[model samples]
Target: MPRLVIVFDEFAEFKGRHPEESKRLIGIARQGRSLGVHLILATQNIEAAVDPEILQNSTFRICLRVGQAQDSLQMIGIPDAVNLARGRAYFRAQARQQFQGAYCGGPHGKRGESVSPRGIIWVRRDGARREINLPGWADGRGHGEPEPPQYTEAQAIVERIQQAARYLRIRRPALVWPDPLPPRLHLPEILARHFQGGWDGARWSVCRPLRAQARQIAEIQPLIGMCDDPARQQQVLLQLDPERGGHNLLMFGSAGTGKSTLLRTLVSAIAHTRSPDSAHIYVLDFGGSSALKPLESFPHVGAVVTRFEDERVVRLIRFIQDEVSRRDALLRREAVDNYRDLNARRAPSERLPAIFLIIDGFGEFKRLAPAELVRSVGALLGGGVAVGLHVIVSANLQADVPNAIFANIGLRLTFSQADQSEYFRIVGRPSEARLRQDIESPPPPGRGLLRGTPPLEFQAALPSRGDSDEEQATQLSLAAQAMSAAWKGPRPPKIRALPFLVTPTAMVEAAQSVAQTDRADLLVPLGLDFDTLTPLAVDLAEDGPGFLVAGTGPQSGKTTLLRTWVLGLGAQPSHDRLHFLFLDFHTRTLAAFRRLPHQNAYVGSAAGLDKALAALDEEVARRKAQLESMYEAADGDFDSGQVIRGWPHIMVVV
Candidate 1:
């Protein structure tokens, strides 16, 4: 018990007489914490006798009636210890305190007549008290030591461990297996003991037991399905290990052969077997299947693209390609061989997960995806594996999957392809159509053949789903909420909003407001720019060149643009400050502004255009002469000054 104390009254005298005794006491002090030994050493010469190591590890220290101030300071780090009165001590342990002992009883006091330390008239609490020996003053008193504590099973075990000096620490060496013997010493018990035969079971028909020792080794990658090998049972797994080849995979099968289901199963396996750190799935549901929808809720999944729009797919592919390039540059800069090495060395925030691109319905995707997307997909398949990019493509027809992509694909899974040429192209073996004559019906869904040294048959497992889309969506949303709540990493990059669409009318209204102010000089407001949604304006005098609005077809906002400029300029309060000459090949376009007072002239056809041109040329010459006369008279450049009379800025539109 920690309360039990073993006191040594004169440790300095004993140590001075026997030096080995002091060494033994020091050793016990060092190891006695683990054991149940508590030592209380009282000495007059503490600095000369006590070891520094013993003092350092001591939990409790008491300074009582030290003779010298320096001795008190050395013992308890304070000179106040020398001022301690008789029978008074300064106690220091977890905290410091000054303690005064309570008076037990006077020397001449008798049992029931004497006051106890707590000032209580002494009366034994125990009904049955024995005559225990105390100091001669209280000899007649029945004083007994408190009974030793009764320990529970757990406390007894702890006490037993604490009391022991040193425990027997066992350090076992690694077990090494010996070579198996030949079949001449046939022993089924040895094989059963080693393998614990179940999935590792295989018949050794005429084999030597030395070469046929069963070993239970788990599949490294997640199991896709169980291979149908007659001799031995093995699982078909999808692996992204570079040593096994690139991670890209291709699946070709006809309709209703579970190609889509297999993809869903693969995604489910990936989500379960690998953590979010290991893999990030992106499901491109080209055929618009709800199978991939549930995966959107998985923390490991980045997105599920159900829309088959070409532009959206193009953008997504470009984003992935850019990411690939970024990772490549990072790897090159870090001098790493692969993504795994780079990820291990990089900081947690900078680390990249293996990106698995699961694309379903290759035929449908090809029909809608642009050329850029196709090229990006090819590049990802060919080069992205080294940078932790894995692709799984599922196609209904063999021809739909590009032959060029076949070179990069590591694994090819085929299911019920009716065409022999398609089967041959995918599996690289001639199909045995006549052999299937024994079967009357079609192969079941998810039943497929894996192409290898010797082709293996397997059944792909499908992930469980909710009964209805609403339930599935609810479950997904709830799961996503939970995942987001649990996530502690750096937040994902914020999604940028597409440029806000600005209508032509809004632009015209803005321009009209600008025209009301004097600061609006030659402001021809075109509709918002496609890239930035900001007002696309051209200051004819400040910004060089004139407006050229071109498009492939009619009513493509070209005419609307010209009308906005004309209306905005005409809306100006100072009508003579800016002039407008409207010329239209198709005269109906500028009909909205025909009645406006700001018009210099409205011309249509070649003859009207010639007349308008002649008028504008004469006006320019007249303005030039007026400006020259003003310059000579004023001896200053009047062109740089405010608007001159009858020399307005002209805006011509065709």
Candidate 2:
């Protein structure tokens, strides 16, 4: 077996933190010499400070740059070692010897050829001596430019670093400089050559599962992913306050870039970190286009609003507003600044949980939602930070979101964008790091750029759909079962139904009993008024005057209005009292009224319309003649109010 030489730097400081490890090191020091193993320990003080065994087992002693005479005496058995100049040291195994160390070049004295204490001449392979030229003479040239100044080993390393930075600059690059460039960055010739092979190795590998990896490290904070910084090797934790970063998140990416997946990972991390009683998630996945459906089943979820519809969006916005107000009042009552403080002081039931609103995509929201929703979102973004309310929205592109909403976002994660301009919009600059041209062609899913003091490249985590086929099909199976089960049982009435939208059936049920009208009058109720939302009943006389109804389009409730009017009059008193006429010029407009007993005429085509009109004219003439006869019978007086008392009201609707 090959021998191993272990070198410990600053052993005294290391021993202070790890006493048990120090003891083990001493044991290894004592026995490793027999097993072809050795320890080369360096420290500002003697190893005895950590444990005396390390000092007793050491085979040789070297004293250099000693600050005290006693340390020099202990190591080299000399008193004059403290006064020694640079590049000079005393070595002792059995007999001590003093020597001047030669400078072998490079910042750390690791590279370049070793030289004797005194310079030596070199002999060529051809048996000739190679002599050094003086500064004044160069290649027998009178000009003597001196071969254009060669850089030292240290300078060459810096030049390589400078060039490496230029080549590694991404379109949207975040440059982080350690306050003092670390000694490791002072690369040797081999390491400097390695940087020439492109690929800075700065980006972190993807986190397969964020939970297990985080738990393995005993991480308690909300860790989204590991940082790409090879030097620091840190986990990118989300900062909930303004000090580290900001709470609100705004993510932008092109389609299929795993924006939704990243969102789920972040939300899952937060859920895993906080209890259900402390944090509640409200997911607004408009259109339900992703794997976010799984999060709905988590107990920490307060509500998962899916289906991209105007009413649903409106309802969610209103709910957020109500919740904000409720929390505000509770905070005031408890004399607390925010939900975190309130929870600390109030009872568990009274405490409010932190609300996380994660909106996956805003395309549907922008198109279908009203302006009020946008305003409400803006208010939440601006003021909800301290109140323990946070919003995380993912959009296909930054342009899809409103400026007001994006402005309040504290943290931003950007994946691949459509074009250069979009990338510029996301990173606030250009970047050569094209997701398409990534080493993992098409860039592995969930790869993104997170902005911070020094931006990071992150690979978001995707949770497993469990291990078995049963787990893989859970979402699909639940959805299929819900379809059949929805109508299988009656839903109990909600304790508090939304006031904005009342069911048509409920509206009809709530209307007062029809009022009995005079013999010649018609009382037909149209639906509730659009503006007032109050019952609207139109009064009409069957004798002469008529009403004309108009509507904008299909959803103008014209069909409902016609149905309500016809159905209302049919149910009151008797069909004989009020007759109805339906002219279905559009074929099916009046089709539903065909079976009503109150209908005197239901004309559809031109021929039917002509026949109905002729019948109506004849009826009017008959009524006039009957009225004249009755007036003549009442002594021919102009006061014919009592003449038509027995005549039936002819209601003609053509």
How do the residues 291-372 of candidate 1 rate in per-residue lDDT, one tens digit apiece?
A: 5766666667776776544444555566577778998998899899888787777786577877778788878787777765
Tell me the tens digit of each residue's lDDT in model 2 across 33-115. Answer: 78888888788875345244655787776677778887776666678789999879877666776767656464433334332
RMSD of every prediction: 30.2, 20.9
Off by over 4 Å in 2: 1-223, 237-243, 287-294, 428-440, 465-654
* Candidate 1 local lDDT, residue 203: 15
Q: Poorest 10 consecutive residues of model 2 by lDDT? A: 181-190
Counted clashes in each candidate structure? 0, 6
lDDT of 2 at 399: 80
Q: After superposition, how far is residue 127 of candidate 1 from its true place, in Å?
A: 87
Predictions in order: lDDT:
0.61, 0.58
Candidate 2 positional error at 345, Å: 0.7
> How many clashes does the backbone of model 1 have?
0
